[model samples]
Structure formats: structure tokens, C-alpha cells
Target: MSTEERPPKRPRNDYGSSDASGPPALQRSTDYWFDDGNIILQVESTQFRLAKSVLAMHSSVFRDMFSLPLPQDEPLVDGCPVVILCGDRSEDWTHLLAAVFPLQLFRTRNPTLDQLSAILRLSKKYDIPLPRSDCVRRLKCEFPTTLAEHDQLDTGWMHIEIPGDLSITQALVHLVNLAREVGLFSILPLLLYDIIIAAEPGENDHDNPNVLHHALRKLSTADEIACLRFHVRLMQPYHQTPLKWIESVPCVECTAAPKCSVKIDLLLGLALNAPNALIHEFLTQWDSHDDWSSKVCEKCLIVAKAVHETARQKFWDRLPSFFELPEWEELRKMDFE
Candidate 1:
């Protein structure tokens, strides 16, 4: 299959230490509870003695698995079943257990990117709704599905907290992988957009040995070309004249319509030099404009507002095509049920 057509691969996890013939040696965890626990779940070399009921409540997968009668040859620790789970990390189990138990306020707070990522993967895999939904909701908050949501945000929304020792580029790279792993495709466009932005001069090398490089390596030649084209488009100046439509609109409030037009035109010209200049940036600068609003008539402001909204919408409509993604309508439906 083509690289773009292939499914994203899950990162190799630490597990399966005791897949051999005999029962694995028990190394019960001191951190996790052992008293009144009915099961010992082994992830990698670490063993966690946790309540079966607690796990079953959060996860339908655990519930269904526990419902099955234990095999005659199954291993046991203190009469409790010792289920050795493979292809997962002990840290992931810790995060999952932390989220399910009342001992920690996992659900009542925002997690670090690493914690959130762990919760997302484990919750989705184990069919746990609360953590999974919260993770999805958090991602959607940053990577909104609709143009309306995106419009409300500023350039400030592009900056996120870089967790751990990772640079901004590395953090974004991790997010992209996490989004794909958890089936949260809605976040892909925003993540990819930000990655390209962060890869600018003095940020980080695209060829660096990170998740971002690996992701790029997985793209097909066509998708890579599309990405390059999209980057070029993002860098290009928004050269369309904002005065084109607003100048022709009737200015009823003032007899000095020509003067009003000159003021509005000057405002737009100044906005083009603003950092990361785009139609939205131009509109925002114009709308909150302290100087120009005083100079222009009310009719001028009204017409300018209409022109700005139209220009921003047009830009939004073309964004997905730049990255070779589906249209906005189709993109919004991507990860939904």
C-alpha cells in the first residue's frame, strides 16, 4: 500500500516479560494497592495489584475479559488471577489506574501532555469513556472542527505548552502521533499546520530524529509534494486588496466618502506587515483599530466589516485544500461517530 494510504503504526510498547511456559515470578508493586485487590495485572516487569471491580467499571474491555471464566492453566497470586497484558507500558497502566481510582483526581483536572496522551491511548483501547471523552474534548478545544470556532481564536492559540524537555517541534510531533493512535483525526490538520509553522528558521530541523521526521518519512511522494506546496502557500503574502469590495459599498453617513475610503485602505496596508499576516489578522487589527475607526465614517466601518468577514471565510475555505485534505465540511465529520 502507498504510504499515505497505510494506517499509522502504533509505537512499540514495553510488555510481555512472562510469555514463556511457566508462571512468571511475582514482583508486586508497592505503589499500587494490594490490600482487598482481586487481580494482579502485569505490564512489562512491573505487577500492579488493583481492584477488578474498579477496572471493570471504567473499561468494558476489562469487564468482558474478567467475565470470562479463568482457564485451568491460568497463573494465580494469592488466589487472584494474574493476567499478563502484552503490548503496553507499565506507565500507561499506572495512568489508567490513576484515572479510574478516587485516590487521585485524574478526571477533575487538566493533565500534562504525557499524562493526557497515556490516558487517551489506554482509555480508547480499554473502552473507558470518561478519560477518553475528556481527552477528545481537550484536543477539540485546541483543534476546533468548525470555522466559527477557529475564527474566535488568535495567533496566541497556536502556541501550546511544550511538555518535558522537548522543544516546541518535538511536542507537536508527539501530539500528531497520539492523535492518530487514538483515532482523533480531527486534530491532524491543526497539528500538521503548527508543525510546519514551528519548523521555520531557528525552531528545529525537519530531518531531526524525532516523531515528526518519522511521520514525514511515512508520507507518499504526492503527499510530501502537497505539504511543500501548502507550506509555500502559507508563506505567501495575502495580496488581495481589501478595499476592492468596501470602496464600492454605499457610505450613507458621510459626504466625505472618498476620505473614508482612504482611511480604511491605509489601515489594511498597515495590517499586511503584522506578524503571520492573514485575512483574519487584517480583520482583527481593523476591527479593534483605535485610530482608523475615528477617521472613518460609521458606514465605512459597516462595509469594511462585511468585506473582512468575506475575506476571512474565503481563506478558511481554502486551508484544507492547501494541505490536500478534505473540504471543511468533510473534515468536520472525519472523526465523528
Candidate 2:
């Protein structure tokens, strides 16, 4: 056998030549490429060209790692060093870098769940305070811990435009997972309530009816029970307690108040069949021209709405208790800053 031709050597970076046993160096991503970048961060096989100074300024971890004296034995490429970051996905690094880089990679702050998850995970791991804090702020803005915070949200059902392609359920599920991941426990009760609203038993869209089911399955048994308990409270008929107020409210529009009470009783009974009905859902129907409140006098409608609001607030104030969480005031007083 004649002598076999040896393959040419690959380019070496500050890290070293790629291990023969490992995969070859990945192609540099066009998205994150910086022509004047001083260093290449290699995560898995993928390469990210970035400024060491910027990274060091934002991350204590990076500062310490970069401060270590370089060995003469280390490899170099294109007069730049290669820093191999093991145990991280290139996809995550891409999102993390996008958040830090001066250039706006994406047009909006509304990052997808995957993007948020990756950014949060890497930012925490790298001890990059800004990205970590940014992620939490964005999440908290979307899933407020208190009713006041919830009402202050600029976009409500009237402005139900979500930032990205995600549905309300998907966004809520993402928040639930993110809150759990980052130990933002205070937001869980509200998030779970939103998820329950989406997972209404029978009338939910078949396209992804089980999104809540799948998300709930990830919870501990106690948490699951807490969610179910809250759902039960939400769906429980208030015919005897609150619905009876309809009969008590004086209405001149009808001569037969007792018969009108029967009609209101029947209308409120509809909630018993609706597993996902919220106070607002029933109130909206009642206020509409087609429901029992429509037949009642304007005074009756006003009283009914006021009573409904009070009842809804009472239920809301007790939400944390249903989930075995601390009081809302306690959650509000605890500062993350």
C-alpha cells in the first residue's frame, strides 16, 4: 500500500484546534456576525463574534473569565481569541447576544416564549444583570401580581392585541413556566386563573384545547388541586346569594317582579353549565339587550352591576388564599429590587 495523503490542518483559535473526536467548528452565524469583533465565543460548534469589553461590562462572569491571563500555549485565529462556552445551546446564545448588542435584532420587546426562556436562562447563568432584570420586568408587566396592577395593564380585552403570534393561553402558559423558573411565585395565582379561563371545559377551541391540560400536568399535586379549587369557585352558581339581588332591586319596567326574578334566576343558571364563565362574561351577557337584565329597569341594571363588581372583587381578593399563597399585600410588599 502506498503512503496515504494527510488532510490539511484546520484553523486554530485561542481555545485550540477542534477536537478530532468532536464535530467540526460550526459556520459563523450571519445574524450575529460583527466585522470588528475582538473575540469569538464558541458554544457547541456554533461561533458568535462579539466584543469582549461589552460582555465584561455587563457580566461579572465574563469579566472574571476574560481577566484570566492567556497561556502562550493557547491557539489563535485571525488575531482573535476563541472562548469555548460548553453546556449551552447556540440558539440560546443567539437570543442572549441579541438582548445585549447595541443593534436591535428584533423590532419589539415582546419576545416569544422560547426567546424569553433562553434569554432568562443564559442571562442568569452568565450573571448578566440587565438581561435578567429586563426579562423579569417584561414578564411582570404582562402578568401583574395584583388587581390594581392587572387593571393598569394598557392592553385589556378591549385592546387584546398580543405583541406577537402567541395566543392568550400560550402567553399565560409561558408566564407560568417563566415565573416558576425564576421564582416569581407571586404572579402564579393570577397566571393560573388566566390559564383556567382559556381551558374552559367544553367550549374551548379544539385547535389547542389541551394547552392548559398539558401545562397543568407539570404542576405539583397541591398546585393542581389549588387551581381546580379556584376553577370550582369561579363556576359555582350564585343564584341564592348574589343573583337574588336582581329581585330585590326595584324595577319599574316590569309589573311582574317575581316572574322577572324567575327569568333572572334562569339566566344566572346558565353559568352553572358554563365551566369557564367569569363574572365579566355573565355581566356582559346580563347587560346586553338579550338577557334578563335587559328586561329589568335601568336602576335594576345599575344595582346589579355594582353588586356584581363587589362580588367579583371579593372573589379576586381571595384568589391567593385559594392557591395557598401569601396575601396580596404581602406579595406586594416583598421587593425583588
Candidate 3:
């Protein structure tokens, strides 16, 4: 099988084996938690967020100094840090607030193995000590999934370990929404494109076609199509939603033909029901995009069109001395018409 087709999650290596009980209680005093093959430095509530910010800035600085282009597929590789320092009993809580502000202030340096070991030791020693739920809860958000149900969690990370044909794509779809939820655009380009958490903000109270038109144009190639699995594909109309029972689809004969006559959309291969916005965006974007190809493989026409050379190169020339791509400056003035 192609590398692209491998299962999304590899075997969980939560510190050599799935001993869900975790390291012996005394080992909890170890400053870090090693699980799922990553060493995380623990930080108390105040320190964890600060550390995450510091890490992000540090990563960005490294990116600029290296002058590397964004990874075409995944976000720039991020090293696992020792867990952020969630406090323990010996660590004084009253004075710790001062430290929290400082830690949350910026992305932090990667903690050493010793630091991580210390955090893990705390977790093992006492189930709850300093920092309280508020602090840990915030730190926990950094991770996509929580450690609550799992054996050993890289609590400040997002991860999925699933096996399937399109697990990566499925993960991407989920990640995109997560990114948008946090207001980050283009985490990593859809180079390997396993998912798209396509979104259009706000509800459609009036069902305006102009709103639809604009949404159609937002049909960037980045949107994920998991939505199609929940809503019936355009061709085979089914009443999956309340509106489906009342709202008739437009022009059934020519434009509305469906793909894969099966009414149940198993393509997602996921148990999730697609949200309304995601479902609509996928259908609109997929069906109407200039990139839409009419062939067996469903390749997009974007590669042929993105570099509208005559138009693009002209813009590329007039930009600030150090610039790339077609410059927006000239293109705005030249009315292609």
C-alpha cells in the first residue's frame, strides 16, 4: 500500500507499553510524563500557558532565521516538550501566581529531560495537589484530546490513534475546524490533504442566495469534505435534516446528478454527523470550483489555473524589492477587463 494509505494512528507507545495505571506513585515526582513516545514537561497552571506561548514564539523565530518555507503538508514539526509545570505540594502556591504570569507571557524554552521527569514525579505522587482544576484545565486545552479517559496523556497536545483507510484525512478534517476555532489560518497547507474542517461563520436565518454566492467563492481547495458523508450527496436527495423535509433542491435534472448512488455516505468512514455549515460548504466548493475535474480520478484544475501567468507574473514584478508571487499592487490597478 502507498504511504499515503497507511492507518492514521500508529500503535500507542505510552512509555513502552499501555500500562494505563501509569508509573509507580513515587515515580510521580519525576518532573515529566513520558507517554505515547513523547516526554512532556509539567507546568503548574500559571506556567503551562506561558510556556506554550514561549514555545510558539521560539518556533517562529527559528522559522524566520532559517528562512524556510512553510511545510507543504503538515505544520512545521514541533518537538514534544517535557510537560508544562503543573504545581505540586512542595511548590508554594501563593508565590506561584507571579510565576504563572511570567510563563504565560511567552512561548517557553524546551524543558530538559530532568524537568519533565520532575513533573511526572508529581503526577505519580499525588493525584491532586497544587494549581487546582482551573489551572490544569487551561493547560489541558493545549491538547486536542484530554487525558481523562486515556492511560497516559500528552495532556498539552492533540492526537488521534486510529486505524483506517482515510484516517489521516479524517484527522485533517477535524484539525481544520480546530484551527479555525482558534482563528489560525493555514496551519500547514493541505499537501497530503487527509481532512478539511471547512467552515462558514454564522447561521443562515434568511437563506439569502447572495450569501450562498459569496460562500461559493470562499471555496478554497483547503476545505475538507467529510461533510458529504453526513448530508446525502447532492444527487440522491434524502431527508437527513429538518430542512431537508421542506426545502427542495435546485434544478434536479442537470446540475443535481449524484455521485455514488448509495444514499448512506460511508465515504467519511467516521461515525460523526457533519455539521450544517461544513456540509453545505463541501458540496458548494466541490461541485462549483473551477478546480473541479470531470474524470475518473477527480483531480482539481487548480494547478493549471493558479499561476494565471500573464496576470500573475505582471504582479510579481512590481512588488517591494524582496517579494514573491504575482504582486497585488499592479493587479489591483490593471482591471483585467
Clashes of each: 0, 3, 54
**Against the true structure, whose lDDT is highest?**
2
User: Lowest summed-lDDT stretch of 10 residues in model 2?
Assistant: 279-288
Q: Candidate 3 — which residues are off by over 4 angstroms?
A: 1-169, 187-337
**Ranking of models by TM-score:** 2, 1, 3
Flag the better candidate by TM-score, 1 or 3.
Answer: 1
What lDDT score is found at residue 103 in candidate 3?
Answer: 37
Q: Per-residue alpha-carbon lDDT of model 2 for 1-337, expressed as tens digits?
A: 3346666566443343566776664678678768888888988877888888998999999899999998896776567788888899999998888788747655544665677788778877788888778767766677666555665665453212345676666667666766666667777777777777666644446576565567567566777788777766755655422344554555555465666676676665665555354434532323334555565566666776677556546666777787888887786555242
CA-lDDT, candidates in order: 0.66, 0.67, 0.30
lDDT of 3 by residue, 95-170 (tens): 2323223436563443322232233333223322232232323223332121122223342233222334533334
Clashes of 3: 54
Q: What TM value does model 2 have?
A: 0.73
List, residue by residue over 1-337, the lDDT tens digit for candidate 1. 9989999764323344444665554456767957789998888767898888888888899999999998897656677888878998888878766666647544345567777788888887788998778667777887776667865676643323445577665676677777767777766676667666655543244355344344455455654566667656665555453334445433666667777767657655765554243422422434554664576667766765677577656765666676778876776576631
TM-score of each prediction: 0.71, 0.73, 0.19
lDDT of 1: 0.66
Candidate with the greatest TM-score versus the true structure: 2
Report the CA-based lDDT of candidate 2 relative to the real structure.
Answer: 0.67
Candidate 3: worst 10 consecutive residues by lDDT? Answer: 242-251
